[model samples]
Target: MLDAPEVEELTPPVRTLMGPGPSDVHPRVLRAMGTPLVGHLDPTFIDLMDEVQELLRYAFQTENQWTIPISGTGSAAMEAAFANLVEPGDTVLVPTNGYFGYRMASMAERAGGSVVTVDAPWGKPLDPADVQDAFDTHQPDVFGFVHAETSTGVRQPNVSDLTAIAHAHDAFVIADTVTSLGGVELRVDAWDIDVAYSGGQKCLSCPPGASPLTLSDRAMDRVLSRENPVRSWYLDLSQLEGYWGDDRSYHHTAPITNVYALREALRLVAEEGIEARWNRHRRVAQSLVDGLADIGLERYADEEYWLPSLNTVSVPDHVDDGQIIDRLLNEYDLEIAGGLGDLAGDVFRIGCMGHSARPANVQYLLAALDDTLEIETPKTQ
Candidate 1:
């Protein structure tokens, strides 16, 4: 017989999360997760599910009846949107500006769609003129772009203009709002975004199991009439509809605790008002920006396209980015991140999201940063 291993009681560090995602969960949401779970189709749970969908719509600023939390993280919601919308032989236009845009292209290809690019440099938002040009050239059936790119800390500006271009070309629109939903200025209906998806862990300040997704009637119509079935069976929206839609039927065993947590998180959003929460993120993130500037760290993206939820700043030429990041966690229990893809080793990504978007967290982060770099805080900062 194998010997029993010595395992200790579970105890994780209480570190402040200021990374790209999985932001600090709100206390109420954490408490909600501890509540007892019921069957996915239980009457009370079904009622809670309806409440969640309504709250999601409110947060998305859309009247889309198809809004619901996907069974997994933000990526799952993203895949579902693409898999259902892009059928075999369809031409899908995707941005080349950030990481998630590449993910969109991959998903589209997997769904048997051909992918084309709308080009923009990393750390910059797509220019409408360029997007219109791409549409004129490719005449794609669908266009996908990242609303707020966590990898580059850039928020796509002129959303309405971009959507207008796609609509003029008779193409459907899909948006990756993982870092912007509930924490940035986004209006799905006003902007005419046909499909949008987000994660619970970023601006929602909840855990990662459940994600938010929404589809307009037009978008759903495309999905329902797709020439080929969606590639992901678990994520097939038609199958998922039976559960999240009015039927409230069996599909998969929902992540009960994560759904409870997401409900509480969206409740916080409704209580705060979406616009107020966006402003709060900006206010707190501005303080972080000021401190970074005072410390000679420049923001990677310009102010007009800056993402308040995720801040990317240049690493000083002389500083070893990895050492400082490690020291901050070891000495101060703080968590920030290095940049990804093209910006790797060139920038530091710090998040000011949902529960983490508070003056206390920003001030503490600034102080910890100062100590780690062996630099004194600026008097003005």
Candidate 2:
């Protein structure tokens, strides 16, 4: 018989998460996760689920009946939204601005969609005219883009115009708000976004297991009327809706612990008030920018298009990004991320999301960053 696995005392580092996601989980949320586990279908748990759905609606700024937490991570929410909405052979207009935008295109393609991309340079917002051109060119059945491009810290300002263009063309607009949902301004109903999905880890400050997904009435109608069933059985929104809906049927065992964490996090959002939370994030982000500038760091994204939650700081020439990130981790016990895909090595992705958006955390990051760059930076001033 195989020997029993060795056991040891469990301990984890107290990290200051100033990176892209899983931003420092609040102590209250961590405690909520430790509460005794109840059965997924227990009356108390079901009540919690109801509250969770309502809170998600408040966060997404939508009254859509289908809003609920998906079982997997943020990517699962993205997949479910696209798979349910885009059927085989559907044309999807996607923006190619940053990593998550490209991810949307890839997911659509995997769902058998013929993708027509509206290309934009990294660190820049999508142009409404270019989106209009894509609509004219493809007349796609679905339109999708990342509202906040996490990789480059760019926020799309043409959401209203883009959604209008898609609506005029009779196309359903899907939005990736993974990094923006609770950290930035998002109005699912007012913006006319048909489907929107986000991760709990970033702005929500929950663990990375649960993802919030919402579909507008029109998007739900499209899902119900799809000629072909959604490709992935696990991600079929129409069926999963029953479980999360008032009927309260079983789909898969909902991530019970994650549900608890999310509920607490959402409650905190409620306690703080949505508008206040938005203002706090903006204030903290401005402080971060000011501090970085004081240390001679430049932001990759222009101010008008910048996302307040995730800031893309340009890596000074000749500085080894990996080296700096490592030193930050080893010495300061803080974490900041390197850029993804094309922007890798050119930028450092710093985040001011959820609980990590406090002034103290931002100041700590600035100090550590200054120390990390001391060697790479030349003496002046």
Candidate 3:
């Protein structure tokens, strides 16, 4: 017989989340999660499901009737988009500008796609001309791009132009909106994006579990007509349709608590109005940027393509970024991140997202960063 092991009660530090994601969840959302859970298919829960789908449509700015929360984190939603859309032996085009694009390539390849790249350096948005050239060169069946890249802090400009280029080649378009959905300006239908996916923790201020994914009717058509079964049975949208669609059937138990949290988060979005929310993010992020500049920190991404939700700043010469990051967390209980992949150790990735995108939080972050730098950086002679 084994004795019961002792475990401590759950008490995490109160942190100001200013990192890549899992941003400060809204208090309302946290409260929602605590509400009693009902059966996934109960009558009231079914109604809530309808409301969540409608709210997601508003968030994605689309009326495709295919918008629903995937049953896992944001990456699960991302995989759903790729797995259903890319048929075996199909040529898929993805960008080479940031970390998420590489993730897209890996997912597509797993789905049996021959991946091709349209190159752009880190911290830069892809040029439309380069996209057009890649399409002409590869003649891909599907094209994917990151709308607001978390890794590089660059928002791809000329979205309509890129979509047009893909459409001209009869290629479907997929957008990674993980960092932009509610905080940044994104128009799915207006931009002619065929499919788009986002996480709840980014701009929505909800804890990560259920993720948002939407597809145009045209995109759904391709998914329905795929010659082979989707590699991932768990992420197959066609199978998921029975539950999220009118049938309202079983498709694995939905994440009931996460769904509740997401409902409250999207309710907040509807209350604020999407455009006004975008403006707030921009305004708050601008203050963060100006304060960073005043403190002699240089922005790593260009202003024209800057992602307000995720800001990247250059790390000072000869300073260990980890030391500063550690000081901020230990001394101030604030959270930020180091860059990924190509920009690693060279920049700091600070998130101004969701409930964390407040003037007070930004001011606090700036003050903490200033104090840390003053102490850590070597003094001039």
Candidate 4:
């Protein structure tokens, strides 16, 4: 027999999350997570599940009956969208502007798709003309784009136009709304998006576990009628339909605690109204942007395509991005991030999402950022 290793009680540092994701979860959401877990298919749990789905519909501004929460994190929901939609030998088009577009390409490839790109520069939104051109050239069967590119802090505009272009080519459209849902203006039905997926931790202000995913009837039909079996049995939406669909049977154990937390978060959304939530995020983020400007920081993304939830600011010539980031976390218990991929080390990624989108949080972040910069600036000779 072996003795068990002793470990200390868990006590993590309390951080004011203002990074790209897993933003400050609402207090109500945290309280919900502490509630006792019921069986995934318990009678009470089933009813709660229905409530969650309905609330999700309101959040996405869609009437799709197929909306439900995925059992895992946001990426799981993202994979479910790709794995079920892209069949072997299908040509899928994805954007090349930011990191998540590459993620879409990878997921599609894993689903046996021949991926093509609709090109745009980092920190820029995709042009509808480029999407049209790609469709004309490649005739892809599926098209995917990030509604809000978290890496570059660029929100894609003219979504309806992009969807129209894909529709004209008879291509299915998938949107990555991981950073935009609830905090940004997104309309699934009005925009004619065939499928959309998002994370709970972003604009939802819920801890990451259960994620939101919805597919239009047309998208669901394609998924159900796929020629080959989906590569990922775990993420296969067809199998998942048994649980999330009307039958409400068992597929796998749902993340009950996360579901509870998400329910509370969506309740908050309903209470606030989605449009009002979007306005709040924009208003609060604008304050952050203006304060950064006042402190001599330049915005990395253009104003026309700026993502209000995640603001990217250009790093000063002599300032070390990592040093400032570390100081903010160590000294102030605030969390912001550096850029990813093409924009790495060139930008600071500050998030104003969900509960973190309050004016107080913005003011605190701006003040802390200003002090960090002042103290960390390279001394003049």
- What is candidate 1's TM-score against the reference? 0.97
- Let me know the TM-score candidate 4 reaches against the reference structure: 0.98
Query: Which 10 consecutive residues of model 1 have the lowest summed lDDT?
Result: 372-381
Clashing pairs in 2: none
Worst 10 residues of 4 by lDDT: 372-381
Candidate 1 segments exceeding 4 Å error: 1-4, 375-381
Model 3 Cα lDDT, one tens digit per residue, 1-381: 999999999999999999998899988999999999999999899999999999999999999889999999999999999999999999999999999999999999999999999999988999999999999999999999999999999999999999999999999999999999999999999999999999999999999999999999999989988899999989988899899888889989999999999999999999999999999999999999999999989899999999999999998896788888888999999999999999988899999998999999999999999999888554233
Q: Which digits, one per residue and each the tens of the lDDT, describe model 1 over residues 27-99? A: 8999999998898889999999999999999999999999999999999999989999999999999999888
lDDT on C-alpha atoms for all candidate structures: 0.92, 0.90, 0.95, 0.95
After superposing all C-alphas onto the true structure, candidate 2 shows an RMSD in angstroms of 2.4
Every model's Cα RMSD, please?
3.2, 2.4, 1.8, 1.6
Steric overlap count per candidate: 0, 0, 0, 0
- Candidate that beats the other on TM-score, 1 or 4, i.e. the better one: 4
**Candidate 4: where is the Cα deviation over 4 Å?**
379-381
List TM-scores for all candidates, in order: 0.97, 0.97, 0.98, 0.98
List clashing residue pairs in candidate 3.
none
lDDT of 3: 0.95
